[model samples]
Target: MKEIIAIIVFCLALIKGEINSEILIVSENNCHQVFDKDQGQITSLGYPTFSSSNSSCTYVIKAKKGQVISLQWKDFNLPAGHDRLCHGSSDSVVVYDGRQIGINNLYTPMCGNHSFDITSSGNMMTVVLSSTSDEFDIMSFYRGFKAAYKSMSHHCKNMIYKTGYGAIASPHFPMAYPANLDCVYTIKLNQDRVMLLEFAEFALKPVKGNNNKMAMDDCDDYVEVYEGAISQRNRYFRHCGYYKPHPITTGGNIVHIKLHSAKSQLALYTGFRAFYYSGVPNKCGLFYGTPSGALTIPVIPQTSGINVECQFTIKSPQVAYYRVRWLSFGQDLFKKGCDENNYIEIYNGFYDKKDKLLAKKCDTKLDEFDTQYNEMLVRFKIEKFNPSRNFKFIYIGVTNNTVKVITDKNQTCTAKTTIVYRYSGPEVISREVKCELFSIGGLPFWASLLIVCGAGGGGLGAISVAFCLIRRRIRARRRYRRFERSDSEGSL
Candidate 1:
């Protein structure tokens, strides 16, 4: 009879839509849950209008990695205190910014009726409601809060890379980066190889308040590069504009790239795409022991940057002179001279600017240049707002007493050969001789002609003509020998 009476009382409590005070734990059916989907909704336990003392309910929201959760509250009606402040209220709803439940993770606490929205910086969020010993009127019911949550995947932050070659883009990349967005990427390579960073495309926010200019020092959006690690002192270059940036080589194996966007800029720009790879050391230094070599700008399809400079010094043996021959050359040239814009300058000594100026060339022309001293310096400089340019040249060490002979053996009756003689001493003299009429096995030309005519059966008439030609050739050869003997005696 007692058990039947208890069952009837429990049925009566359910009919009244009341929660048992002893049932303090929240079950899976009573709590709201969400996962990787787009949206979800949650309400208080026994929602739509009910009050419970000593009851607990929880709501869990989740999203994908690298995404955040956004929540919007529709209705909030907790029992208010007499002072109208929810700082120390007994009946309240607490929001945890992350999945952990702790005092430090609490985002906010609400007690009275209010509607607001908030966003979590992580992939998960938790909302908890607890009504301890009912402090308000027991006869009246209080409606709790209801909220809707959605996943947002637009936030950009930290990224890491560990490979030989990789690419990085802005927050939205092909699209415009979000306003007030700061993104950073760290790239690491093997210890023996250096890092090379090249920009395939770059279109940042242009400078404002200047009609004639397309770039400036003050930029609304910019990208910065660092050499070893990310720090203020290790910054290598900072750039902005629509022009593509030239390739940058770091000193060590690590590189850090940082991108910053201002809040005011709203125009859509395709930001930038940068590529990085491992490379050998490419910088200004002294080169020796290399007999013949070629030097040029390492990166292709390069663009404009601020006050960039590259220098190289070529040193030869003590007794030899340096000769530089250009295979290909092209750059932005000024009408008057190469003092402005992008240019390459050559000096005659070990130091670049401190030495004597040999010549400066920026136009599209192939030329040869020789240095007076044994060492030579070549420097290339680029200013703001310039097109891409490059040059290729070969350098060789030449001695004064060197003789080079070149011969072609493909001709049937005659062979052409060139001989170049370089004289030593203070006053240098060089000359080239071209010899084309020389017979094989020291045979006279007229004799060879006679043999060929005899073999072809041209009769004695050819023999008579060959005999006369042979006598004349013998006389000519004697005269040439006498002249050579006289010349040799005069030189001695």
Candidate 2:
């Protein structure tokens, strides 16, 4: 319950701050650079526009100790001729989990056009862009890739990662985890996909009794793995030993991991390290709200999932105003504000004419927006997937009488309200996000209880019809099951 509260606290935070009106493009000389700062952006030569062929760049970011790095590819584009399979593509952008590039560090080598997010296990992350003569086309152009990096000091407790595959560890691995620490890592994937986990290292405070005897069921520090929505009965296994466990596999789309430590052996046990990957993926046109969450359009390794078109309608409660927040961005091109290609629109009251435009933007700076009525229709578009998610918008239920913060800096937003792109792919994303910014005070935190949970959202209000769900973690000392042995560890 405490973890649930912490995650929602940010969703209710007042969206009050000055909005920056420009997009800063880094210079070409900044390539092959090493950053030890807390946050920054890396771009390939010319950004927000195409550059000459054969231009490549690389960047490495290192965070402070006890911290990890998070990345979001806001813009990623390549010439048409370079669109080939991962192994066959001549022009590619690769991301590594560590400071250097190698087979073990390779996360993904993207060739065509794609946008997504990544989180590093330790303190460093690497990005490299390369192209050859086969990719150079006198008649074609490419924008390369742009990404934002920030230091993540939180060990990702109660954080929801919908990117499908990534690495997770106790707050700061290799170093001893602090005492009385509790955290949860959740991986949500498409229902069709299964997941697997292989622990590279594992250690827990030993509960050695007389003669240095260890008990398997009895533990001081431990890790718990769950199959679905982290309920006591849904637990797959619990471990409190020091040896690396066998690879864990799950039969469902979502997996939950919980970690706990006592104060007795803070300096002795270094905790555990593990990597998780899944085979499934998108939430489009979906009407649901998990306090504050992002729009997750999974990167389906196939050619079909790369192209996207999504729409949503966020509405406020009877007497509240609808709101949206940002968790990431690619490039909000200030110079070429909202265009027919990429944009976002928020409306209050009637949709046809009486609607008030609360916010409007292009691939430029999007902070937060609230409506003048009890509901708002939100429309976000990108003629092509921008390679980085725009911003994770949250519905902060603000009172209707409060001072309005958003305004319609109208620039022909109405002129291009309806657009038809020249591509076809993710058509199922025509969801209506009608549950955000509304009062969900009575709703439970676990998504399993919300009706939209099936469609990848935790909702309230109308969703409260769903009473108590089967899946729930009661306390810090959640009930769990034990795996028999390493070789026999199995999926739920």
Candidate 3:
């Protein structure tokens, strides 16, 4: 009687189609399916049995509202697809978000031994499998894949790319992307190479006035590119309302790209596609804003006898002026003339040689420079391949709109900078001018000035009371000050 009961149980298992792993995912006759079970197994046609050749099917998985579908592969084994053969001779599988199966909707194609988790952006996802080649004697040859799906929730995280080359597109390229996206992707290269980016397709929300400015004042649905991390200091490029953008080459090894769609963006639009690669970086750039950190110019490889020169321009908006502080300069440049072959030329305004000269300096050990103007140009020319040009600087922005003027005759600054460098009698660039660059509250410069004045030379009354004591020190220091201000050749 016990043996009879055991035989009956075995027959019942076979009758229910519980073979292989004992859980039938899809029946043999029904390949196309809509999976409504919250969590269940999904597999290829006749999974764990055999997948017929040249056969294909699609499976749509839907989760509850406000929840996304998540898929994880347990087993995946299929004939490899050859890219060189144009996918004609092998079998493959594709997983994508939403119900559509178009060019832009695909995740990376899956074949030999790949198991990963894919979470949809919405509540629906589709998976498709196709078999095209029959290399074996019979059509029913290999067992295919096994995966599980369930409802889940997700959040967006910042992406960092370390690959040497790759392509990145907005959520669903060529199709209207979802609303209210805020994503940041960064590409970091090795020390020897810098990042180069080119945008193939770009169409953000249009500007209100139909302006075509690359550096837009007001941008909503926009893209921003920075040479470093996303911060007020590294922001140099921001664009909106354009079809395509010019290629960008970074001065350093890291590049950060940010894509933002405002909460007000109710409608959807096809976003953008960009490609990036790492390569040898040559010099030249447009640097904006105040830097909280120091920047070093990276070196490029060249033959022995070549002289490579590069120039970069720094500019501020109309409301601010530049405050430059060279960390290791005043001590190195105190008594020496700049080198002729490998020297830096500083111009008063934006134009390099067309504007009046500020200083043809070789070294500026540690000093403060307030360019009471809105723009400045810097040119670095060095002969032969030196690993470093020994140039480092911190460009800053001060929220002031006026140029400092003691007298109309002493410091005559205009569209072209004019300085009274000629010693008509005993006139010199005074320490009082240096104080003007660093008078902010609790600043390092102000704190250092306090320490210097509060010591023995408390000939007090500064900025108010100590202001007179500061003048006495300026009179004592000017006798030995370098006459760099007078060296400019008037107007260029």
Candidate 4:
């Protein structure tokens, strides 16, 4: 009879799908997911309801460190053929594990639909989205250009590039050139030569190159056509140089400059303006630039504790390439692990300089940057600077407005940039004034005060509290010891 009963129980266990499990997790709705610890196979857990509504319920789990967690849900509801409730069906819950860090779904995965796995397995313990596109995160990639371009170009016969920031709706709006320069222009990468250029009131004839060639007047406006290898002496400049030069030609249009990086890291930067010899100051300190003919714009001192920011419009008719490089001079300035390269090279979006051909690259996303250092040089270049086909550079990554370039990056660092004109034309070069890092946390003042106060009141309040707690603990321990001794003696 006992054997028969055991057999019946075994059959019931099989019917209920109850197998010995290994790992467990508490779900947002208090449902439990069971799987083998070794194999990581989900034995049984019915369909999960993914909620995106802000006021959805939460589930709590009691677990230890080093446990793997996952969520199961879908992006859409009713399999695409059902009803009027399709709007809020894709909202999901993102679980933040208190202990070990790993991927957590912002929403549950759709049935049978894969690839939306957002993993975050870092010690930082932050539930940062690893999957699903983050348009804002791309901006951080461009901070590498903090040491490249200097100031506005003095040969501003017709073109001006200025940095502007604030709350704005569209990516291309809110862009304004420096007020000091006369002619202001916006370059867009488009199929039809649609570019914009305004003539400065005080137009000066450009100095001729040594070849006695007209050195290309109004050439700065057509940076899209100049197709050649791009290079810069400043290693930390943000703009990545291209092996092939691209000049501008299309007028009233924006251009895209995509860089390819295969093996070595690429530093990309872009800015406007070039400083002349008269404005260049004789070198006095590492942080100061020489006087060049161009007026020196005083470098802004970083106001610590506040977020400093700058937003520029990247009106490329096509997709554009962006890169950033920075010079690290202060302590704690080294790249986390790489000692060989003094500067950090970060590619903001898609495209690598290492590719054998530019055709192999594609734009994954578009975004802008924020300044991150106390002082930095900036250099910005598109495929070309103009509308006439005489210059060469690809304004658009593929075609025109079908794609767009945007800047979303900002910084709290001070900046002083100088543009070097190749002779007396708008063809100006760039560099930046170095800056020193200052602390605004008031930690030094507070630390000194703490030391002084403690020295004066040494062993006073702390000792008093310590003694009281210690006595109480000791009395309790003594009473327990005495009881134990009395019991042992009485037993004897």
Query: Highest lDDT: which candidate?
Result: 1
Cα lDDT, all candidates: 0.61, 0.56, 0.58, 0.24
Put the candidates in TM-score order, highest first: 2, 3, 1, 4
Q: Which tens-of-lDDT digit does each residue in 201-319 have in candidate 1?
A: 68877667432243334777888876565765455445676655435545456777888889877768878867664554433212333433455544312333445577767664422
Q: Rank the candidates by lDDT, best first.
A: 1, 3, 2, 4
Model 3 CA deviation exceeding 4 Å by range: 1-29, 83-88, 114-116, 134-141, 154-203, 209-217, 224-239, 242-492
TM-score of 1: 0.30
lDDT of 2 by residue, 335-417 (tens): 36667756666666547343367677554444665555545666666544533533444454432123322223232221212
Better of 3 and 4 by TM-score: 3
Which ranges in model 2 have alpha carbons more than 4 Å from their true place? 1-29, 36-38, 48-56, 64-66, 79-85, 100-104, 132-135, 155-157, 162-164, 188-196, 205-215, 248-253, 278-492
How displaced is residue 5 in candidate 4, in Å? 34
**Deviation of model 3 at 426, angstroms:** 59
Query: What is the C-alpha lDDT profile of model 3 across 1-492, one tens digit per residue?
Result: 665664565455556764454333434356788897788979886565444456677889988765557677888876655652225436778776668776545565677554445655556789888767544433323457888988754333365555455445566555765667887877776776765567766777766753432335477788877656677546545666655544555556777778888776645578776766455544432243322223345554442246657776665442234565553332333234556556667677776554477766655545656665657777866555444344555554442113333333222221322222110111233323222344334467667566656655643343446676788889867853544444464532
How close is every model to the real structure, measured as TM-score? Answer: 0.30, 0.44, 0.40, 0.18
The number of the candidate with the highest TM-score is: 2
**TM-score for candidate 4:** 0.18
lDDT for model 1: 0.61
Which of 2 and 3 is the better model by TM-score?
Answer: 2
Task: Quote the lDDT for 265 in model 4.
Answer: 19
